[model samples]
Target: MGEGGKRKSRQEDAPAPPSHRILTADELGLLKVSEVPAGDKWEETAAKQRWGAPDKAQGITRLQVHCPDWSSDRCLVAAARTSGRVTLHAGSDGGDLGSFRAAPPASTSGRSDTSTNAVQALRFARPEGSQQLLIATATLGGHVSVHRCPVEAALSTALAGRVVQTWEEAARLQTIGDLQAMDVSSSGRYVAVGGEGHQLKVWDLEAAGGAAAAAAAGADGSTPKAGEPLFAGKAGKPSRSGLQDLAHVTALAFVPGQDDKQVLVGTAKHKLWLYDTRAGRKPQAELVWGEGRITTLQPQPDGSRIWVGNGRGHVEALDLRAAPAKLSMGHALKGVAGSIRALALHPSEPLIASVSLDRHLRVHHAIKRGSLAKLYLKQALTGVAWLPPLPPAPADGAREEEEEEEEEEQARAAAEEADGDAEEEEEQQQHNGRGARGKGKHAGRGKADGGSKPPAKKQDSKRRKQ
Candidate 1:
C-alpha cells in the first residue's frame, strides 16, 4: 500500500486502552480492616474502655479524630467542648497535638466568659509546593483561626508545636449569616467561606494583611467595601427560608488538580453546585445529590467519582462518567442518627473514614463494591480527614515505549543505507560490463541475462532486509 494509505489503516486499527480499573481491596493488595493499626478492633477496645464502663455515658456529643491521607506523615485532631476549651489530640494513641481556648465574642449579649462555642468545622489545606496549614471554625461566635503546625520531628506530640497565628470573625449577621460550614482550597492560597449568608466568599490568604483585618471589618457593621469575589456567578435570590433559600452551602471541597480554579459546594437542600473561581457569577453546573439534603460531598483524586453523604445516614458513590448517572449505595452505618459530620477517603487505600452523631468514628472499605466493614471508634466521631497521599510514581511503561521507538528508527535508517549501497554496486557493474558486451556478437543474449541479474539481486537484497 502507499505510505499515506498504510498510515490511515493503522490509525483506524489502533486500540484504545481503559484509563482506570475497578479493583476490590483484596485484588489491590489492601489488607482487611482488622489487620491495620487503628483498625476497628482498636476502636472497639477504646469504645469499651470509655463507654463500656457504668459511669460513662453511651452517647457522645462530640468526637475529634484525624485520618491523614496515606500521603501524610502525621495527623492532628482537636475537639471543642461545652466549657470553651479546645482539647487537641495528636494520634489515635492519645498523643497530644495541642489545646487552646477560644473566648466568646464580646459583642453578643450573653455571658461571654461562660458561654462555649462548638467547633463546626476543621480542615488542613494542601496547597501545591507548600507545607500544610491547619484551620478551625467555631459555630456560635463566628470565630475562624489559622495555625502553624510544627513538623512531626520538632515536637513530641502532634499538638505540641501548634502556634496560633490569627483569629477573626468571618462575616456580619446582616450580610453573611452564621458560619455553618467551611473549607480550604487545595492551593492553600484561598479559603472558600460559606455559611448562613446567601453568598460564598473566597479568602485570599496571601492578601497584604491576614484574615483578621477582613474579619474585623466584617464583624463591625461598617459596610466594608466589596473586594473582588472568589466566584462571580449571579447571586441566588433569598427566600423566606432565610439561608436555606439562598446558597445554603453545607459542604465545600476544592477540585483535585494542579489548576485550583474549580470548587464543588453542597447545599442543605440537596443541590450540588460547581463554581469556577474565575467566572465569579452563577454556578457552572447545578445538580441534585438525591431527594434529601446533601450533608457531605467529596470528589475523588481522579475527579471521576464523587462520594456523597445524605441525611439518611447512607453514602452514595457517584459514577461521573456513566450515562444517566450510575449511583451505588456505599456503606450504611446503623447508629448515624444525626447528620454525617465528616467523610474522608484514604489517600492511597480504599478505606473510607466517616464520623457521625452516633458517637462512633467508623472506617469503611470498598465503598464502591458491596463489602462494608467498620473501623469502630467509641466516641461520637465528629470529624475525620486523611492525610493527602504521596505523589504518584513515574510510569515505567511510558519510558519503555519511548525507548522502543528510538530503536525502531535506528533500524529503519540502517536498512535504507544498505539498500542505497546495493543499488550503487549494481549500477557500477552494469557500467563496467556495458562496452565489452556491446562489442561482442553475443551482445543480445548478454543484455537479456544482464537485465535479469540486476533485478534478481535487488529482489534478494530486499528480502534479506525484510
Candidate 2:
C-alpha cells in the first residue's frame, strides 16, 4: 500500500479526545441496567446456595423492639427463639448481641428442654420515670418471667439481664391453659395474658411490689401467690354449648393511649373484642374481623388504627373509629404467601415489616398497602421487628483524642512560658543591669501562643505614675 493510504487508515483508528466527545443523557446519569429477579418464581439455586440445613433450635419464634416513650429511635431487638432463649440483636444490622434462657432448666437433666420450653410471646416496656428497660418472656410451658436489660450489655455469649419478676400459670390459676398471647400496658405497670380456652388474666406488677414479693412467693423463682388479675373476662359465648370451640384468645393488645384502661382481644372464633376494664368484665363491643383465627394484633403509636394478621394469610388495617360494628371491613394488604406470624411498624417511616410461615420477610407501604420489598429468608420465619434507626454518633474517640492533644499542647506552652519568664527575670537582675521593679513590671507580658496575655496591672502602674 502507498504511504498516504496507510496514514489515512491510522488516522481513522485514533480516538477523539475529551474536548471532542459528547455524552448522551443516559450516559450522563451514570445509570446501569440490570435484570430483576423473575416475578414470583423461586430462585432454587440461589436459595440452596444461601441457606444450609434448617435447624428448629435456632428458629426465631417472636420479636419485640424496645421503645420507651421518651425515645422512639431505633433500639435493641429481643428475639424469642425455639430453644427457650431470648436473644438480643442490634437493631441497626440484626447482629446478635446476647441471649438469656427464658425457661428454667430441666430438673432431672440440668439443661433446658427445648421442645417444652419454646418461647411463645415476649414484650418490652419501661415504667414511668424509670430508666431501666424491661423484657417479659412467656414460654409454651406456662411460665413467664420479667427481666431488666441494661442498655450497654452487648456480649454475645453472656446472659443479657436478671429476672426481676416471675410467675407460673399453674401456680396462679389451675384452668388457664397454654399462654398464646401476652402484653404489657403503656405504663408498664400492668400485664395481660390470654390463651387457649376462656383464659384471660391481667396482673398488676406495681401492686405485687416488684421482685421482693416475687422472691418470697417461691424458692424456685416461681410466684406462689402472684396476685389475682385486675380484670378477668370470658372470651366466647356466655352459653356453655359453643364455649369449647369459640373461647380461645390468640392475640391481645393494650390500647396505645388508654394506659391499660382499654384492651383489644382477638379470639379464635374470628371475633375482635374491645374490653374496657373500668366499665365491666364483658367486652364493650364484638366485631367479626376475619374468616380465620386472629394470630396477631399490632396497634399504632397514636392508637388511631390497628394492624391485624390472621391464620389465613391476610393482613388488614382496621379503622378504630369505625370499629365495634357488626361487620367491619378493613383494607386488605396483599402479597403475603403464608400465614403471617408477626408484624412490626417502622420507627419513623410509614412502612411495616412482616415475617410469615412461608420463610419470607416482607416490607410494605403502610398507607398504600403496596409491596415495597419481599425476601425469601430460607428459614421458617416466625417473627420480625424493626429496630429504631441508631442515633448519630458523638464526635468522640479519635476526634476527642485530637481535641485533648491540642489542649495538652496549649497547657505545655503555658508552663514553658511561666518558666521562661522566671529565667528572664533572674537574668535581668544578674546580668542585664535592669532594676528589679522594671523587670517586675514585665511579669505580665508573655507570648499569646502560650495562652497568656499582658495584664492591666502594668498599665495601671504607669497611669498612677503619670
Candidate 3:
C-alpha cells in the first residue's frame, strides 16, 4: 500500500461508530428494553411483604437469564435481592415463576435464620452433562453454595400456575465472603470469586465433586480443608496485585477462548491486569485507565477487545492487540449520574446492554456507538446478563415424520440465505460503498464541488468591470 493508501487503511480500521441510533426494538427482541416490564409489582411486593417492609437491605441487585436450550426463543430470568432472596421470572415478558433460597444449615437452634443473611452474588450456569442448571449463590461474610435447578419441573409448575421451588444445596464451598464479585468461566469448569479481601480465589468445578457434595449434606456447611484454591493472589508474585495494605478485586472475567487460560482482572486503583493461570501467578500485562477504580470488565465476543466500566461513569475500550494495551475509545453511559453498574453484550449481535446507578437500562447499538434505547426502570440497577436462544422442542405425535422433512428443508434454506447475506456484507465492506472519498485525478470531479471554484475569479471580474 502507498502512503495515502496506508493512511486511509488506518482510518478505516477504526472508523468511528456512526453517531445515530440506526436499529430499533422491532429489529431484535433483545434490544427491546423499552418494553421490559417496569418490575413495579416486584417493587410493591418487596415494599409491602418482602425485605422493603423490614428494612433488611434493598431491592434486587443482580439479574441473570437462561434459555435451557439455545434453539428456543424464550428464557428464564432470575433476579437476586440484597436481602437474600432469589426469584425466578420466566418468558419474554417477566412473569413470576418461583422463589428459591439455600436451606439454612441444619440445627441452628433457631439462632440464625434467613433474615440474618444477605445474598452477596448470584449467577446461573449449566454444568456439562447430566446436570441441567446450576444456581451459584454467595452471601456476605459466608460460604458459597451451588443449587441444582429442576428447570423442566419448575417450568411445568410455572405453566401449571404460580409456584415456588425450595432449592437444596447441590454443592458447597467453605470460602467466606463479603464476596463482592463472582464470575463463572465459559467452559463452566471454574468459578472465580473475590472482593474486599487479600486473595482472589479460583475454584475448580470438578473439585466440587464427592467431598463437597458430602459436605453439603452436613450441618453448618463444610469449609474446604486448609481453604486452598487453584490460584490465589500470593505475595512474592510477579505482579503488584499483592496487598501490603487493603485492596479489592472489583472486576473479573475469563478471557474468551476454548483454552480459557487467561483471566482479566480490574482493581480499585484503575488498573487492568491480565493473568495466565497456565503460566505462573504473575500478571502478563497490566494497563491503567485513569478514571476512578475499574468496576466492570467485559471481554468482547471476539477476543480482540475488552470493554471496561470505571467508577467515574465512563466506558472505555482497550485494544488487546497492542503490546501494552492502549485505550482506543471512551464514552459515558447515557443518563448516568453515578458509576456504571454492569455491561452485558449480546451473544451474537453487535449490541451491549448496560445498567447504571441512575436507574436506567441502556442498550448500546455498537454500530452507532450510541444508545438504541434507554428505559427508566426506577430501581437501583446493579448487574445484567443476556440470555441466549432456547433449545428446540422435540418433535412428536403423528406429524413427526412430515415435520422432520420440513425442518431439514428449512435448515438448508436458512444456511444458503445466510451465506448469501455474508457475501453481500463482505462486498459492501470491500468497496466502501457509501461516502467514499474519490481519489486521484477524479477526486473533485463531482456534481457539486461547492468549495473548489478558482479563488481569484471574483477579483478578476471586478477588475474587468473597473
Candidate 4:
C-alpha cells in the first residue's frame, strides 16, 4: 500500500492514546463534610378526646430531596413517588409547609386512568433580583407548573400551604404522552421539557408573562407570543428527525461551558446527543456509553467537562475542552463503576456524589494528577444534595493533642504486631531444623550398622524383635 494509505490504516486500528497529564485533587479542592442526614416526614397525630389530648403518630419512608446549588442552605423541594405528591420544603433547614397535587392537563384528562399525576422533575429558577420560582412536571401527564415564592420561604414553610400559581395545559403540543424529564436553564430564561416524543420544547417564561397569562397563550401562540418561535424543538422537524431514533430520553441537561445555548439529551440506549438551540441543527456530537443505559448527564460549571452515568453503575467524565488530538479528549474518569442512578457535582469542591441501584452513594474526589478517591455510603442512596458549609467551631488544643497521641499509639501497636509475627516465624524455623537433624542422625546410624547385613538375617532379627 502507499505510505499515506498505510498510515491511515494504522491510525484507524490503533487504540486511543493514554492521557499524559495527571489531574490532582488539590486542583479540585477538598470536599469537606457538610451535612449528611435522612430525608423523611413525620407528623404527630393527637387523639381527639373529651378530656384527653390526642396520641402522637409517626410515619417513616424514604424520600427524594432536591437541593439545587451547594451554596444553598436549604433543599428547594422534596417528593415521594409512592405518595404521588410533591412537597415544597423551606431551605436546607426548613420543614415542609405546603404541597401540590400534580394533575393532568385538561386536554389530556380523557387519557388519564389515575386521579393524580406523579411528580417527575423539580427545579428552582432564580432570576436576577426576582423571587425564586419552583418548576415541576407531572409524570404520565402533560403539564408544567410554576410557583413563585420568596427565597426565605423555603426555609420557613411548606409549599402546600403557600398559594401556588398553576399553569394548566401550558404547552400546545397534544397527546404529549408523558413528561419524562425537564430542566431549567442556569440563566433562568428557558425551561426545557422532554417526553415520549422525539422533540424537546423550550418555554420562555418571561415572554409567556405569568402562569395565568402563559396558559392563555397555549400551544398555538394565539396571543402576543413571548418571542419568535415560542417553542422550538431540538430537531426542527417532527416526522423522521424526532427522538424516535435516539431511544427514550431519560435525562436532559444544559451544557455549562458552551458559549452557544446547548443541551444534552441522554437516552435509554446510552447515547448522548448534544443539540444547539441557536442553530436549530442536528446534534454536534454523539457519545455512546458502553456499560449500561445512561441515566443522567451533568456538565461541570466551566463546560470543560461532562459527567455521565449509566444503568450498569459507571460514571465517567469527558473533557470536552481537550484538543482533538489529545488522547484524553472525551475520556472517562478512572475508578468509577456501577449502575449510576443520579449524580450531583459539589458546588465549590472538586467532588461528585453519585447514587446507584446498588444503594451506594459514592463520593468521588478528583485528586491531583488524574487520580480519584472514593467514599461509599452505608446504604443505597437514591438522591444526594450538597448542604452549605456551616460556621467553624472554636479551636480545641487539648482535643487536637489527644487525637495526635492516639494516632501515635495506634502506629506503635501495628509495628509491635509486625515484629511479633517475624519472631514467631524464626522460632518455628529453628524448631523444624532441630527435628530434621535428629531424624537424619538416627537414619544414618541405622544404615551404617546394617550396611553388611543380608536381607534374610535382617528379616529374622526384625521378626524376633516383634
Best by lDDT: 2
The estimated TM-scores of all candidates read 0.55, 0.63, 0.62, 0.56
Q: Tell me the tens digit of each residue's lDDT in model 2 across 382-463.
A: 6665433223343334454566668889999999999999999888767756565566666634433334334566778889
Best by TM-score: 2
Selected candidate, larger TM-score, 1 vs 2: 2
Order the candidates by lDDT, highest first. 2, 3, 4, 1
Instruction: After the best TM-score superposition of candidate 3, give how far the Cα of residue 289 lies from its true spot, in angstroms.
Output: 0.6
Query: Comparing candidate 1 with candidate 3, which one achieves the higher lDDT?
Result: 3
Model-by-model lDDT, in order?
0.50, 0.62, 0.59, 0.52
* Cα deviation of 175, candidate 1, in Å: 8.6
Summarize candidate 3's per-residue lDDT along 334-432 as a digit string, tens digits: 434467887877766777777666766567665567656665554556666654422323323324445655887999999999999999998987777
Model 1: how large is the Cα RMSD against the reference? 21.8
Task: Report the Cα lDDT for candidate 2.
Answer: 0.62
Q: Identify the runs in model 4 with alpha carbons over 4 angstroms from their true place.
A: 1-77, 80-84, 90-94, 104-112, 155-175, 207-211, 214-247, 257-260, 322-337, 367-380, 390-466
What digit string (tens of lDDT, one per residue) describes model 4 on residues 21-46? 11111101111122322121101111
Give the per-residue lDDT of model 1 (tens digit) for 1-466: 9755654555555433221111111111111112222323323322211211221211212333344432222544454554444555433233444455443444356545333254455555544554444444444444445444433331233333544323223322211346666666666566666675545666555551343456465655342332564454344434556643655667766676626776767777777667777765666666665566777766788866677787767676655443123333333434444556667676667766665656445555644433343444433344455433222333454444456568879898988998899999989989878867767758777787788788889999999999
Q: Stretches of candidate 2 above 4 Å error?
A: 1-55, 67-74, 93-96, 106-114, 150-175, 209-222, 236-245, 322-327, 388-466
